[model samples]
Target: MGWSLFRRSRIAPGLPVPGRCGPRRHALATERLLLFTPRTRLDVAAAIAASADAQAQGWLGTKADEVLPDPAVRRALLAWRPAGEDGRRIPRELAEPFTPGPDDPLLLVCVRRSDLGYAGALELQHLAGEMGGWLAPGCRGQGLGAELFRAGLELAHTHLGLATVRAGAETGNTASRRALARAGLVPDQGPRRHTLPDGRVVDAVWHRHDTATPAHCGDHQESPRRRPVTRSGSGHRTS
Candidate 1:
């Protein structure tokens, strides 16, 4: 699917329609979504708590009660990677990249551009394979997701040197799937079940996007359908 870029001549126009599709619309100029390094542990916790509360209302997915109090969840949120020896904390350097770390691009927190509030995060553990992301419920509708994701893809390509990245979303998650497709990722298959922190199995769909793929960012035509909600870790996406 593809969309038309809608731009208004500022010199001669009143105001551009907000919904007008644009190609690779940049959300913020600085391109920093708040620091996700280990130093921002408290911020990461707040983000995780907010995401969990948002998930409870079904904006993203269901969160397990077990993870609610665990500090490891915050670590995962901060680094956008799995929790380390501390369980509730992820090393700051690991969130980005360090000399003596795993080759996998660490998970990074996604913050709101305006107030630096924790909006969501992205996780991409495997190269050229599956990656995922999530947002707080309040942050779901404004189109920031697409912008952040585009930036994320660029980061993956630049830092990790990966030519391709993969992702997944539930069939009912219209916003997320649309964000992925708008980011040039393609939907692949049907509902796949995965084990959650609380040992519950939930269904989700798989998607993929390759840097080598000849895709455009303006094509956002996917729609979300209603399905039983599932969880992806405090509603955060892991690579």
Candidate 2:
């Protein structure tokens, strides 16, 4: 899994909607994927469904007793839309867009350009300058993991305006570690042990990508400072 650690916070209702004030919703594109801030119930539902896959849940660590919506129902919800409605128009339920506070994590849904299908999700924690993401079962092991995480770096550095972005993975998850490295993140210092949301403990390794220029000894340029890594209950999976 390409999961990272961060404190979780609730997104309060009545926050200024996207495009009205604060940070506007973002959309990013890669050669094979389109990443966008979720704007509709369908978008949210699809992301949840992708994360609920049995293989993904293992690394993502879900509540043991929590029963998610039926897989069939989730797929049906993704296929539903208002009759004769423009596919591009925002629906009534999403009139008040989800807006995260400066410190809150923002989730961007990833879709395959070839079919516009739900491929996975990416999470960006603005305050911590870190990101984590996962791919759907159908999309994993297809070399999409590197692209998914590269998009995360773009979100943190280009869109979110962060100079440094970080990610962590269980030491034994070689696939995820390779994907992070391929996405330009290098090894960094962090806690050797991490607890997954499911309460399992494992050896952990951290990686980071920094866009800031290094400060010279005599120059007055101030290098970017690193933020302390913290554990959270949310987990992320990747190809």
Candidate 3:
């Protein structure tokens, strides 16, 4: 519910304590945003509320529907209060600590650095090497999408130790495509027709950013022109 709840624990000065998610890996900060694992049910609720916006839902609602299929269930979720406030407690299963596997997709709650307000969420699917995210209505149209996605690229390459990251956008979604390009993803090949979680079929375009060298044919030696990019930093944090 607060930054303190997600604060890092250190074994000693300059020494981060390692947990199941890894040391100092639960939070990432950018020039304008902070991405971190959800620490409470409220964090997830905030994200749900953000994504429920009509405009955002058109592109992102399917996941929310799957997460809370029943309208009654969703209402209850949004209406639920923190423990001790209203004679109710969050369910144990929902409150249990999160321990994700190495290949699990990373989901980070996004907050604005300027106001510490809930912005939205970012996700990176490791096996697919893809990323996607949405923003709250209040945070949209201010050019933060690119920053949000750049943070995704940072998470993939710098924090998660990924060689490449890819993203897809509906061909007509100029805003999203522009943001992906601004985030340093170059247009790449992918299926022209793609199905959304909501079952809509749409024209899609893929983009990717690669730090790895392209594979060569058999018996071919590496060429200087194809050298992998050298990258190093800890600007992005993760869990």
Highest lDDT scorer: 2
Better of 1 and 2 by TM-score: 2
Q: Which candidate would rank higher by lDDT, 1 or 3?
A: 3
RMSD of 3: 9.9
Off by over 4 Å in 2: 1-22, 64-69, 74-103, 213-239
lDDT by residue (1-239, candidate 3, tens digit) is: 12233333321122221122343245555567777766666657666666665566566535544444445554454454322124556687655555444444567777765545677788776445678887766778778888888877766665555677778777777777777888788988777766666667666777889877433112121122222422110111111
Ranking by TM-score: 2, 3, 1
lDDT of each: 0.46, 0.62, 0.59
Query: Going through the candidates in order, what is the number of backbone clashes in each?
Result: 13, 0, 1
Model 2, 161-201: lDDT tens per residue? 56777787877777778889888889988778887767888
Q: Please list the Cα RMSD from the true structure of every candidate, rounded to 1 decimal place.
A: 12.7, 9.4, 9.9
Per-residue lDDT tens digits for candidate 1, residues 71-169, read 466434544322332344545643442221334334455555444445666654533334566666556677766765665665445334455556666
By lDDT, the better pick of 2 and 3 is 2
Pairing residues by index, what is the TM-score of model 1? Answer: 0.55
- Scanning candidate 3 in windows of ten residues, the lowest lDDT window is 230-239
The runs of at least 3 residues in candidate 1 whose Cα sits more than 4 Å from the true structure, single-residue gaps closed, are: 1-35, 54-66, 69-105, 189-191, 213-239
Against the true structure, candidate 3 reaches a TM-score of 0.67
Error of 2 at 128 (Å): 0.8
